[model samples]
Target: RMSTISSAINLPTIYALSTPPGQRSAIALIRVTGTQSKYIYHKLTGKEKNPVPRKAMYRNLYMPGSNILLDSTIVLYFKAPHSFTGEDIIELHCHGGRAVTSAILNSIQALNDMENGIDIRYAGPGEFSRRSFQNDKFDLTELESINQLIDSETELQRRCALSSFNGENKVMFQNWRQTLIENMAPLTAIVDFGEEIEIEGMESILNNIKRDVLKLKKEVQSFIERIEKSSILQNGIRISLLGKPNAGKSSLINSLTNNDVSIVSSIPGTTRDSIDAPIDINGYKVIITDTAGLREQSDDIIENLGIERAIEKSKRSDICLFVLEADSSMKIDESLNKLLLSKELQDKKVILVVNKEDLIINKDELRTMIHNLNNEMKNQYPILPISCLNQCGISDLIDLLTKEFKELSDTSDGADPIIMSQRVKDILINDVIFGLNSFIDCLDSDIDIVLATENLNLAIEGIGKITGQVVGIEEVLDVVFANFCVGK
Candidate 1:
C-alpha cells in the first residue's frame, strides 16, 4: 500500500513488484508503466513486436550486454488510456524468485536515460489507486471499497467491502446525489415564484419541492443508518463489562480471551481497574474490557478512581455487560440491583451475563433464576450463561458477540462503502449541511441558478474526496512524501 503513494512523484516510468515479496511460485510479474515501455521491450527482445495493447505475447528475454538468456515470459501490453495506469504498460510473467525478479528490475532501470529518457522508478504505496483515480478508472467510493476489502476482519465486513467494490453503495449514492441536484431545480424555482413572477408551474413546483424535501430527508436517514453499520464493521465495536465486586468479570474476560490477562484471585479487589485486550472473534475485532467492580466502599483512592473509570467506560461503550455470579442466586440483590437499575444504565444496551455456571447444581434451575432476575429490569437484557473456569459456554459467548457485531454492521455481502475515516465524515458534514443546505437557504435571494449549481458541484467534490473520487493529485503526492519512510 505504501508503494502506491510514492508514485505521485513526477517520474515518467514506474515499476513495482506486482506480486508480494518472499514467495516462490510458478510465475511472478514484473510490471512497468510509462510511455517508454515499448522501447524496452524492443531493445531486449530484438523485435519491434509492439505486443498489441491488452494482448499477451510469448517472448524470450535477453540481457543486451552479454546476449545471455534471462527467461521466457508472456509479455502483456496495455496501450495508453486503456490500461490500469492509463499509460503504455508492460508486464512480464517470469519465474518467481528473488534473484530473477531483482535482475529484471535492474535491467529495466539500466536503460533509464536512453532513447525514451524515461526515469524508471518504483511505485509508492497506494500510487496505483492514486493513478487510477487520476484517470477516472474508479471513483473515490471504489477506492475505499478496495481498501476495506483488504482490511476486512469478519465475513460481514468482507461482504460489505466486496459489495462496495462491486459499486453497490456508490451507484446508490451517486443516483441519489444526482437526483438531489435535479430535484433542487424546481425547489429553487418554487422559492423564486412571487407575485411579480407569476410562474406557470408555481403550484406544481411548490408541491414537488415539498415532496423532494421529504425524499431527501429519508435519504439522509438511510445514509446515517448505513454509516452507523459501516463504522462498527470497519473499526470493531467496544463491549465493556461492569458489575459489583467479584461478579466473575475477570474470570469471564480470561475465558473470552483464552488467557489470564487480568488478575483473577479469589480476593474481592484483586482487579482494581479497567483491563482491556483486543481479540479477534469470528473475524471481527472485539476489545473486551474487564472493569473494576462498581461499588461505594473502597479505602484506596486509586481503587475508587478505577471504579469511577469503570462506570465511565460503561457509559461510553457500544455494548454494556452486567455480570453476576450464578451462586449468588437472588432474583435481585436489592442493594446492587437498585444501583444497576438506576436511571443511568437503564435503556442502554446491556447484556446480563451469569458467570460461574460450572458451580451450579442444575443448568435449568440456574437459567430460570437468571431469566427471572432479568424480567425485573426496566429494559430486557440478553441472558448469557457461561463459566470462565473449565471454559464452559465460551463458544456460546463468542457466538453471541458475533451475532451482536453482525447486527451492528447490518452487513450482507461483500461491497458496502463506508465513511471509515473522520476526515471523510467531517468533509461530508461540512460540505452537505453547511454548504449545500446553506445554498438551499439562499433560494429567496438574488443568487442565480448557476450559483446553486456551483454549490452542488462543491458538495460533489467534498463527497468525491470522502470516497477518493476526485482526489487532488498534489494531495496524493504530498501525503506520500510526508509519510515516506527511509529507503522507500
Candidate 2:
C-alpha cells in the first residue's frame, strides 16, 4: 500500500513583503509561513538551535549558500499551530532600502533550490489571509471586515469595520444559530422517538418552538432594516448635479471637490458622461457626480445616452442639486418642471441651487424669482444661491448637504452591526428570510413537525454559511479575498 503524505508537510512555504512597496520606507516587513519557516530562519540568521518563539531578536541575515550579507534585521519567530496560518512563521523586519528588500527576497527563493523537500514561493494576493481563514484564524465575516478596515476612509466606515473585525457580530450570529439548533431539539425528539416514547407535553413544546422561531425571525427582519438604513455610511452619500446645459454644474462640482474634476467650457454638452468626484463633507464621505446637462431634446446619440444616464443617476442619488442660472430668463421650463415633480424624485431630496449669484445684481429680484418658481410648482423646494466663479456660498451649500446627511443617519441604529458585504445581505434576505418564512408557514393548524424542523434547519444553515461554520469554504474564498492586497 502506498503511504499518503500529510497535507501539512506537502503544503508549500509562502513568503512576501508585508509592507507597502515604495521607493524607500522606514522599515520593510517580510513574512514567511509554513513547514520550512524555521529552516529558512536558521539559514538567514546562522543559528544552530531554534530561537525562542514569539521573541524578537536582532540578527545578521545572510544568503543561503553564499556569505552575502542581506541585512542586519529584526526577526520574530512563531511556532507551528500557534501563529497565524497555524504554521511555523518568521517575520523579517528589514531596512526599507530597495536593494535590501530585494536581496532578502532573493535569498529566500534560493532556499527552495536546496534539497529540503519543502517548496518556498512568493505569496499571491490575499494568500496569507486565505491561509489564515483555512487555519481557523478568522471566519468569513471577520475576513470581509478585515478588508473593509483596510479600505475604510471615513469615521463611520472605520467604526463599522472594527465592530465586525472585533467579532461582536460573530458572537451574536453564533448565539442565534445556537438558539435555532436548541429549538430544533424538540422537533428532532418528535421525529426520532415520537412513536417509541409517548412524549408528553409535546403540544406545549411545539408551541414554544414556534414562538421562539417567530421571535428570531422578527429580530432578523428588524436587523436587516437597520443595515439597509445605515448602508449610506458604508457606501458614501451620493449627490447628483442636475440642470440645463451651461448652468454651471461643472463649475460647482469643481469647487466642491477643490479640484477641476469635470471639464468647464463655454460650450454646451461638453460633459458627455457622468464624472464622479469623491469628497469629504463634515467627516462623511460624499461622492458628488457631475452629470451631462439635461435638455428637452438632443440630436446627438451620445448626448442623448448621457442625458438618459444623468436622469438614472439622479434617481439613485441621495440628494439632487437642481442647478439653475441666476439670469432672469432662467425660469424652470415645462421639461424641468416635469422632472422636478416626477415620481422618480418623490422620495429624493432636491435643492434648487441657483448658480452664478454674482450676476444677480438685485438680491430682491433673485429672491422674488425663487419665490415665484416655488409657488408655480405648488411645492416649495429648498433653494440656495451660489457663485462658483467667485467661490461664494460654497460653505453654505456644504452646510445644507451636511444637514441632509444628518437626517439620513438618524434613521439607523448605531448599536446594530453595520453589514458592508452584499454577500451577507443576500444570504440573510434570500436564504435566511426564506427559511424563516417557510418555517412559520409550516406552523399552521396541521403543524407538519417534519417540514417546520427542516425549514428551521435551513435558517440555521444560512447563518452558518455567513460565518463559514457549516458550508464548504472554497466557494466563497475567491469573492471574499478578491479585494485584498498581496501579502495582506
**What's the lDDT for all of these models?**
0.63, 0.77
Candidate 1 lDDT over residue span 1-488, tens digit each? 22233333355677777776658778888877776778878866767656787777888888755577778889988887788767677888988988777777777777777354566667776666556656667665676567667655556567767766787667766765676667666645544663466678655664564466456646755676677677865665678776556666667766765632222222233233335434556666566554433233221222234445555666666777767677744555444454455565664466777787888888788878877877766456677787788777778777777676666666544434354444545665777544566455544465445565466556666555555544464663344333322112
Judged by lDDT against the true structure, how good is candidate 1? Answer: 0.63
Question: C-alpha displacement of 166 in model 1, angstroms?
Answer: 1.0
Best by TM-score, which number? 2
- Which 10 consecutive positions of candidate 2 have the poorest summed lDDT? 260-269
Candidate 2, superposed: residue stretches over 4 Å from native: 1-11, 20-27, 48-60, 78-83, 95-102, 113-119, 134-136, 195-198, 232-236, 259-274, 290-313, 328-330, 361-369, 406-417, 471-479
Identify the candidate with maximal lDDT: 2
Q: Assess every candidate by TM-score.
A: 0.71, 0.81
Candidate 1 TM-score, C-alpha based? 0.71
